[model samples]
Target chain A: MQKQENLSKNQKIILDLIEKSSGPLKAYSILFNVKKQGIKAPLQVYRALDKLIEIGKIHKIESRNAFVACKNSNCQVSKATAFSICENCEDVTEVSNLKLSKYLSNFADKSGMKYNKYNLEFFGLCKNCKK
Target chain B: MQKQENLSKNQKIILDLIEKSSGPLKAYSILFNVKKQGIKAPLQVYRALDKLIEIGKIHKIESRNAFVACKNSNCQVSKATAFSICENCEDVTEVSNLKLSKYLSNFADKSGMKYNKYNLEFFGLCKNCKK
Candidate 1:
């Protein structure tokens, strides 16, 4: 994992906000939440987010255009990451199963193509949402 | 699979453009490509896209904010879908492996949450791009 000390001031601020959220946070929402901290522009937020993502401190939920802090300690080195998303509640849970990650890393297509990185998002009703 | 005859005019026009593409097509790109076919507004294209996605005629590449035609005959009924994306070339290929789909459909997390729908996007250099 990349050392936390390497994060810039803005990156740390944004990452902290994401880590505190119960669910994923969108860029605009994050910007709004951090405005008091002197993050006045969207580009500042985006640049910090891009850096955070590069260091594996945060991940973007592509489907929702939201960001979430990486939950797994081993996630920085893992080539595959998966998330279970509740469509109704908008809750996102990162899957950290070693076996699952191994299976996906070794998976090959008909053309025998192998992938170096993968993001899987599963959509369904959460336990509470199903009730 | 949803019958092709069930598609509305605008849906058909947008679907054809997506299907004919070598890679995924974004909503605005689809609208631009079909403007001569009478698709005048972004909402019209989005509405048709939502319907097409609902019926499984096309699948969205969440990371790229683009849509691609489902290449597998069995894809309409499958609960899980996976794509291998070439990061360098921006090429996307849908993975239609029965075994992979089955494995994911049955996958459970630590809380024993099983997903009804999943979309996996793998990123890597394609065979041609690697050379």
Candidate 2:
């Protein structure tokens, strides 16, 4: 079983920043936070983000080239770590539900295809923004 | 409710190309297919993809800067159209379920956050690819 662990000081702030983010965060944003805490160099921030992700505590959002913490704390409940991002506010609100995920998985399994699986990212405004 | 309509003769080929694809497709790949049908200029295919997406007939996978058709025929059952895409083969499996989606939505709603929701796209090899 994968266990959740606290990130290092540098990693914590970066994680904390993303956890509080309204939208997906670019690598620069993470780097910015690191500089504020007396950490220097782009490498430091990237390394921290890389390590945190490897620990399974965070995920990289490929669409926006950003990152976010895994909202789910553990694997017991089997919650997905992916989400839907709003292009306007950059606020990520999980997703529109899991029905889409299961359907895709089943579809691929039936297709007899072998590939790397990625979460789908949709960019758009929320209901409020539409108004 | 939005209605599904067949694309124009030109758009049909583009849509067909994506629909029959086993994985997500990049814009260049779309352009590749477009050229095969005597169509030139990248704008033509992009316009077609844009229009298809607008009518809610097809979806753009932002993570890969690629595209795929909506597997769902209608919105009555209320399916989240995002997916889990494979990095290696570019094959997309729906997800590894709705629980993740519902949870994210509930978390956001509870957080008093108004955001443009996006499906979180993750990248990794499938079970077979791992072997």
Candidate 3:
């Protein structure tokens, strides 16, 4: 887990916007939302996003090309992140199961290849969508 | 597993190109490679890719924004796809493990969210890169 300190102005602005959002925000959308706050360019937003992802303050929902604040308070680094995404509602929820994380952290394939970083995205209808 | 039959001309051409590649191929790159074969526009490649992915003939490496042929022969549908990616070398390998697939397919999070579809990508140094 990396410590969150000495963040740049743009990083802070972008992270604050992502953290405030209830759903994931794409890079372009983040740029659009932060334009009033002096963040004007797409490259600026992307740079801030790269930094935020590097420090584990935010995570990219790769499947959706969207970014979300790191909801897992226990891990500040992005080593074992998992999300449950709703197919119908498009809601993404980070799963904070210690047991599941532990199991995945130690998991290896039949070829004896061990991985230190893994991202798992599960898709299903949420309870509300299921009804 | 869905049967691979009655594929459109573009779908077959795109799938063939992906299957021939040693690494994942991005959509634009696929378009570039297949330009001579009458696939001119990006949308043409994207539509073929969407169809291929829908039928489980290819899998998208979301982290890389690339597509690769489905290397797991046991399953023709994209219900349980997993890949181990080398962070240093950028090589991706599909992992075919029955136990791992079964465990994940039946896994439920702490909040009782059961997912029927999952795509897991593991990142680490490969054997060559570790040397």
Candidate 4:
């Protein structure tokens, strides 16, 4: 596991907002929420987001262009990620299945390419939404 | 297999541009390329992209915010997708491994949320980039 580093003021502020949210948060939305803290620019939010993502503090739901807090403390770096997204409710959950992560981490292709990172997203209806 | 539907003028023009490219194309880039062909607005390009994606004619590399032509004819819909992306050269290829696809397709999570779709992207150094 990578050692946790101290976050700057802006990163901490933005990350706190995302971490507090029930679902993923978008860049603009993050900026809007953090403006009271003087993080007014989109670039500030993006820089914070990029840093947070690099340190495995959060993962981006690429399909939705939003960010969610990383639930697994074992993931010190955001290299291999999998999420289960509810299509109806837009609820996003970080999947912590050992078998799935292991299978994907060890996966290789015939392209002769050395895979170092991967992201997988599964879409479905949540229990509540399915009811 | 789902029957192929006829593409409108805008759709055909945009699809042709994306197909002729070696790598995935972004929305703005697609709009720029098709401007001479009368696709002057961003909405036009997005509409065409949405339709192309719906029919499995193209798949979006969400991480990169680009679209690539689907090589597998068996994928009549954009429900399941997997891609191998070269981090160094940004080269992207659609992975057609049957076993991998089947494994992912049949994968059931403990969430009890029936997954109907998934997208996976593997990042690595391509053959040429490794040299």
Candidate 5:
């Protein structure tokens, strides 16, 4: 693969965490795991995570207070807002399917409401996490 | 409506709050509103809410720390787990479509994993919240 944007040591570690996770992961787990690699302090990881989220390099699983890599980096996923999560596998996947997004978009247009943010979630076992 | 289980005055007030809301509500907002109605202790409301959630009387919007009454009280919805939520109007909806439910179930069967609890969320403007 073409070399993705080079990241600092901290970012690289976080990226690896998302890449290797069985499913989506919460921030606390990231904080705990990063320390295993010798990164110190609570804020350093979150700061790096925040930056990762901002650049669309990663996505936050809003319901679980966790982060996951955007399955499709080129897709238009927004980190500042909300998205769906799979409960079983702990994998946070993007919910940008055209049908669902448009269904919700139509709802917003009719409501005439402006919110700084919003959330949508579906809780269930994932394709992998299910029993 | 067949009189559901009779509720204490505090519980009754909470039901009314859910009934009148334009969308789902977080626990803190319920506490504030209950207090406005003269329920003295904060614990009383949460205690009631906890039970409401336990007995499948109300659904928790995990992403937003909020609650909504089950639109279909008679449906087999579980209060112990997660479900989809609408971010726009704060409405919580169930994602029990047979196709999706089976999709997740098969994945879990293969993974051999179990979680005491899980989260599933979706974020977007509602049919009404989209301007």
Candidate 6:
């Protein structure tokens, strides 16, 4: 992963916007939000997003087609990711449980497939949504 | 989940195509394949894909944005899904491990969040790819 200081101008601008967002932001919405900052064009947003995701500065919630900042300071690569999504409210929370990560990371099957990465998503109602 | 007999014409077409496929099929690719069969619009493809996924006849590989037929005969709902994806060869296999599925289904975190659905994907090189 490249250092944050090495980020290009557009990358920094896009990353900053995502980091400030309270929840995941879609590519179009990110492009819309940064339009005032001279970041025009959907391709530009996608390019920056690709780089941001590559650098582990942001992660895409594949189910939602949205991007969120990596809250784990220890995450240098976006290889292993798990998220809990509230079906009712569409709330997404990054799961950082050590045991769960370890279990998945060490998971092996009879297929003899050695895994290098994994992504898990859990869906249900959140605490607030349960009320 | 609906019975196989309840599937609409478009859904049956899409499901049959996916089931016959050995690999995952992307939305546009599915659209292109079914075009000759009288399904013209992209929305038609998407709608059928959505219903097929809902009924567990298909599962979308979120990482690849591709759809694969559910190989597990016992899986009547598209709730818990796990797959082994070969990074090098792009070979995707639906994982049907009873232990893994049970573990994930019973998984609970300290956040008091109860999950009703989950999707897990593992990425690695397949035996053929590794060779």
Clashing pairs in 1: none
Model 2 bad stretches (over 4 Å): A1-23, A28-48, A69-79, A82-88, A93-131, B1-6, B38-41, B74-79, B82-88, B93-109, B112-131
Question: Which scores better on DockQ, 2 or 4?
Answer: 4
Model 1 lDDT per residue over B67-129, tens place: 999888655643577889998889988887888888888888765454789888888888888
On residues A60-101, what C-alpha lDDT tens digit does candidate 5 reach at each position?
665566777766646343523334445544555555555444
Ranking by lDDT: 6, 4, 3, 1, 2, 5
Q: Tens-digit lDDT track for model 1 on A4-106?
A: 6577889889999999999999999999999999999999999999888877888888889999999987566435778899988889999888888888888
Reference-based lDDT, residue A53, model 6 = 88
> What is candidate 3's TM-score against the reference?
0.94
Interface RMSD for every prediction, one decimal?
Answer: 1.5, 5.6, 1.5, 0.7, 7.2, 0.8
Model 2, position B120: C-alpha lDDT score:
51
lDDT per residue for candidate 6 within A1-131, as digits (tens), equals 23579899999999999888889899999999999999999999999999988888999899999999998888878999999998888878899999889989999998878899999999998898888
Docking class of 5: incorrect
The interface RMSD value for candidate 3 stands at 1.5
Comparing candidate 1 with candidate 6, which one achieves the higher TM-score? 1
Instruction: Give the alpha-carbon lDDT of every model.
Output: 0.85, 0.63, 0.88, 0.91, 0.60, 0.91
What value does the lDDT take at residue A67 in candidate 1? 90
Q: Please write out the lDDT profile of model 2 over residues A101-129, one tens digit for every residue.
A: 55434334333444344455545566656
Which sequence of candidate numbers ranks them by TM-score, best first? Answer: 4, 1, 3, 6, 5, 2
- Which digits, one per residue and each the tens of the lDDT, describe model 3 over residues B12-104? 888889998999999999999999999999999999999888888899999999998987765567988899999887889998878788888
User: What does TM-score give for chain A of every model?
Assistant: 0.92, 0.73, 0.94, 0.95, 0.71, 0.95
CAPRI verdict on model 1?
Answer: medium
What ordering of candidates by DockQ runs from best to worst?
4, 6, 3, 1, 2, 5
Which pairs of residues collide in model 4? none
Query: Who is ahead in TM-score, 1 or 2?
Result: 1
